[model samples]
Target: MSWDPYATLGLGRTATADDIRRAYRKLAKELHPDVRPGDKAAEERFKRATAAFNLLSDPALKSRYDRGEIDADGNERMAFGGGGPRPRQSARAGAGAGGFGGGPQGGPAGGADAFDLGDIFSDLFGPGFSGGGRGYGRMRGRDIRFTLDIDFLDAVNGAKRRVSLAEGRTLDVAIPAGVESGQVLRLKNQGGPGVQGGPSGDALVELNVRPHAFFRREGQDIHMDLNISLTEAVEGGRVQAPTPSGPVSLSIPAGSNTGKVLRLKGKGVGGQGDQFVRLLVMLPEVPDEELKRFVKKWPKRDQAPPRPS
Candidate 1:
């Protein structure tokens, strides 16, 4: 069947290189055999998409295809955009070295247009061809990319995660400390197998860090809002605060107010970054009668409340 690479990729001929790459990656993630195991329809779609990507991703091949010099399968097409077989020339005009007409002054046959049909055929047939054809050299396998979701704390501190791959294989990916969302971790020689003893491709794992309930990270620093009772804000005392490492005793200053950020050094990411705790003063859910009476008769201060730091 005649294949249209652009249609297979769901793109127009005017799509840019980046567009083609993105389209193929999206399709690969959805149609990969590993992703949709046992789905024969998806497997076939994956094969077709991969084949189209292989051809369209090559600038030389893509140019030739755009110019109608080659078919979708990379085979040479008939001259002048004709679908019929090429018209044969006279025996004398075609008879020469390897059946190619000689160039002017015996420079070279067909001049700049000359190319070895044997090499093109060899490329099509691959290295396994044993019918007196030169085999294509060893080639490194293509790299594979996939996304992995991890806990927020795992991203702050280094962690190892096991991921499954094609062919029932698994990989242990080491996530480094302070890894952010969209960061990639590459595992060498963990992707597709190489051809003809060539080196294998690498596996690229793109991380998606799950958000924490109370913690937010900025660079290496961690920030979180902690609720404190009004008495703790006014009288000051030791209170427990959460950090990326663990809970720690925090000394609240007297008269501390909301928006006051306290720094806990070496408690953020990998024990290198700091954790900032912002205090939010909270009132009692149900005020007692005695406290209400005391508040009703309390004198108003002449000075305004201090601004939070």
Candidate 2:
């Protein structure tokens, strides 16, 4: 359809190489096969965006395209600018040693092997066409996609996973440790077969890391609120704290207060981080008269109350 590359990538002709790259990356993220699986329209746009970015990212090729020396596909345009078909001229001007004004069997003016038309054609239509006529005979296979959701701990700790394909076939998948939401894992040659002996497309697994019931993430650290009785906050004791790996006994310092962050080293995802436990001192539903009396008459209790952290 003679689509302009800039238009395909949603950019102007004046866009710099970096601008083009940024535009492509943004579009690719939104339209990746794994992101919008089964959406053929988005897939087509994604491919076009990729191709346009590739063409515009090369300085020589982009300059040639801007000068009308080449088309968006990096092919020399059939008609130069607005002029008619330009005659192929000699590389050294006039004619070669073997020919002059047509002669020596009308040998190409420059050298014996003047130009490589095959290379030009190949460049124009991707590396698919090799001969005189243009063709996409061996088409690449269509990529298949699947959404895989794993538990938060499993995702953080890494686990052997499996997925059931559309055909009801189960395949084992390796879940990488510390994998984040929206991450894509590629499965080679697990998609649709290629046409005319082309290589098969890949299987794209879009991973979703489920949120933990009590745990939250910050960088590599895991955070959760550790609830303890008000008495425990005043008296030091060990309490059971949940880690992604399992429940572990965590020591609470005497006089521990609410919003206190306690660290457990090497307890976070993949053992690369520490687990931060935020202490939440819970008051007894049944009020303690002695504790209430003590708090009410505690002389130095509130010269200044601690501010919220």
Candidate 3:
């Protein structure tokens, strides 16, 4: 494709360096391979945007490009003098098979111009390519980020999950126990592939723990409300209670009212915290005729609970 650094970065010739940077960052965040795995079109756009950024980020390169001294690929344009555009002078007199940006073959000089591809690469890849070095330089790959939604139990108990990547690839990620929402798990060497022999980047996975139906967590403690019949609350007996691990037996105290809390040690997050079970005394949905009649005649029924002062 015809590379236009300004257009690729969604900018114009009048755009400032800061403007260019902002545009590139916005596009990279939206078009990065990790954001939309296996989307070729976005990946291509990402690569183009990166290339454009590299070119435009460097002041010298940006100036040269703006002046039409070099093309989008960093190859020098036809050598133009004060008079007008002119062909680059070939080193070989007869061999006109010039390298990049050289005159066409069989031109003034039969041989191609001795252009150093390494020099061009050194300008683009940033440092380490100089000192008369040849071939592509090494550059570290870009870091990738992803969001992984997991069940609340899985966050409390360490679990393994597979993360999907581009090209039908998968990465196994280990979620630590007691991981909270917004926590990031980093996998080294799991991002975009490096350029040449450079090292690959890391993969950052942010956790999004899904909410439970009735259970809530505070710090390391677990809290839930357990409904109990009026008989069980007044008589005080053992009843089944729900926990993250499983159902457990709970003892209710006599005359227990609503908002009574029961603590189960070592039954919370990671089996190290505590579970607070609040008792909710509930009456039958329908009124019982026999109970209603008995209450009306009972003398103690007139004794109401003391109200707050």
Candidate 4:
């Protein structure tokens, strides 16, 4: 007796298509050949999982197996070989019965009757059994590749997102902290279905971090531009800057220029890198009449430039 595909996969006879898919995915993840390369035990488990998936994935084959018309290993039942129902005969004496038990002359039971085991096998297990009893052989499912776009903040802070596949399956993927663009996340056993009891493939997710308008990443460091008023730039003051963690106060030096950068230590993604804030000093727009009057009497510096004659 061949191994029961359903039993090998740990699925019931009434398992639905979705149930079969879920089981295959779970098993493939646990028994992927590449993941456990050089390990004989894992390889055997992978083979068994693949076989179960192949048998259950096909509607015709699954139906036949469920009806007991085919063996668990996908071989045709012995009773089907005689062609329909045979005349009742004692099991012990039937082996020696001559001429297919008194059939018409030169009929299906006569000397001219030739039984092609290949034809019977083909009818039972589809055409082309080149692999002997190894069952159907075909390409496994294609490996799936897709990109997941995550917010910069989320990438730094970690987040959970739901991803949908073309097969109408949605999976919840957790984005780890400090993940960068072009990073690949492998979800084992989420790829295409295998054929002939072969293992399914995998789903590979490429991470793409969306750029933030205000925050930028430099290695593990976080960079941001801080807008400061003329008074704050000239007088040097404490300003609030945004970091991956949250808003934090940063000190600005007196006479700070438009391009001066200040670093806040250990305020970045993993709290191991620094946060850099570049100052952008904004001058006040043309003053109104009341402000212009006050500025007209403001102190002015007297200076002279030396020119070579």
Candidate 5:
């Protein structure tokens, strides 16, 4: 029977990372082996819970599993199933893919339907291999895993990455939009060649998104501190701020203070998340004497109970 992590964890395809984590944690607490000693069902459920959580925890693995690229255990499934893309099977009586002429080892046995001893003997002592008490064909190719380092900006705004292989070959990986660090990008039929004409494997590329100096991400949301002038903060106006899409005008509230967060909707990763801009007042390196004088000479307000600043 095939394994479905979603079924094991009682989740759906639309489950997010947080939802997965929450579900796994709840199941682990309930199905913990220690809590139900000597219960085989509990132990098995516990093991399955762990496996499902581990598989679905990684964004890349979850994505691949959802797309049916890989199985619950991270093994690649034949993309073309049910006789799809099969190497030419031997349908001849004696003339296999590389078998001999239709006849026995004692020359060509006469008859339109002669008994092909070669076919019989080959089946007896042929190259067919078995595993776990079951006969099977040649093994499929092995998947190759690579860790690719990409720029923060490139990660935010997806870009194409060319990976150089040892055999003087290159692979083009299409980094998807809003792809996070540690997410996998699976390239189909790009790994080592198939064994004895079996299906080729895949190339699993794990993305390593470099961190930006001023910008950081949480899920799809992006956060950054915007340096607003004192004048801009005092007098609310439209101010331009740098975003992944480019510089965008943001309206700052009048009398805004430090630590105020302004939201720019649909400006984050792939424009699906909101960009949070924290207002930070930047002071000039050289103090303005005129400004200081104005403050010094300004009328003082009555000392009242300080409200929330």
Candidate 6:
């Protein structure tokens, strides 16, 4: 898709170089791939945003684009009279070796289209006797790859970022939500220049998401550990638990044990995965003298013993 550079950068046609740089930097911080890695949508936006910025960042290119010589996507428009601004000649030169009456080959008078074709071929290949040779060599630019690392929360919520190229150029990337690792983002014609007027290659950005301390992702679900005291587990009460959205209250059933799992629905990334709270019973390292005495004097008369069949 053709994107308007000025509109993408939030600037006018008359914006200065300094203004463009500042705007790019500001948007880059929020949309860079490093800030929202593993997000496919965000990566696509980043590519488009950077492509727009790259086209507008160069003064000469921007001028040419503004003058209607090229489109926003950097495609040269066909000028008037066919290829360029050059003028065409009349049909006399194209006639079959004679005047309008007749030709040496006994054919009708050649039209302007024949003359134009001859002119184009003569300009391109230097007046060949006949058509037996191919024209132009193939030249392709090198492909560029960018690796971006994003924070866990930013990957989930989406963010913007800036990436600095080897040539000292910076790109503004917009990261979208719900991206995954190893996703490739392609920016067409944004790579190295062609050797002999051939089209440029592309820039590819790969995504990498950072790990979260509290949240462990399983597919789309998020898992977390919830610590509950012995009293709360025995009495069954509402306890606050940590989730990606924030802390939420969870009901602990009476007589709950360690390793018990409580599920909180729609609390994961994109609100599609369930948040599992794995209960961990934390025991005090040191016990008081009274507690020790009570534990020592506890009755076990009703306790049942294991029987083997």
Residues forming the 10-long window of minimal summed lDDT in candidate 4: 96-105
After superposing candidate 5 on the true structure, give the runs of residues whose Cα lies further than 4 Å from its correct spot.
1-137, 301-309
Candidate number achieving the greatest TM-score relative to the actual structure: 3
The local lDDT score (0 to 100) that residue 291 gets in candidate 6 is 64
TM-score for candidate 4, residues paired by index: 0.52
What's the lDDT for candidate 3? 0.64
Among all windows of ten consecutive residues in candidate 5, which has the lowest summed lDDT? 97-106
For candidate 3, lDDT tens digit of each residue in 1-309? 235778888899998867876786687667755556789788668666655665666665567668865556544444221223343332111111111112111101012321222333344444554312321133444444456678888888789887554324578988888999879787887754444444655666667788999999998999999999989988999999988888999999999999989999998898979999999999889998887898899989989887899
Q: Each prediction's TM-score against the native?
A: 0.58, 0.55, 0.60, 0.52, 0.56, 0.50
After best superposition, candidate 3 residue 89: deviation in angstroms? 55
Q: CA lDDT of each candidate? A: 0.63, 0.61, 0.64, 0.60, 0.61, 0.56
> Could you tell which candidate, 2 or 4, scores higher by lDDT?
2
Candidate 1 TM-score to native: 0.58
Q: Candidate order by TM-score, highest to lowest?
A: 3, 1, 5, 2, 4, 6
TM-score of 5: 0.56
lDDT of 4 by residue, 72-182 (tens): 433333211011322212111111111111100011111222222233334444586422443313324334455667788988988888866533577677878889987
Query: What TM-score would candidate 6 get against the native?
Result: 0.50
lDDT of 5 by residue, 218-255 (tens): 88889999998888888889988999889998999999
- Model 2 lDDT tens row, 31-130: 7555577897886676566446545665655665688654454333321111123322211111111111110111011232232323333444357454
**Models ranked on lDDT:** 3, 1, 2, 5, 4, 6
Q: What residue runs in model 6 are displaced by over 4 Å at the alpha carbon?
A: 1-141, 194-200, 300-309
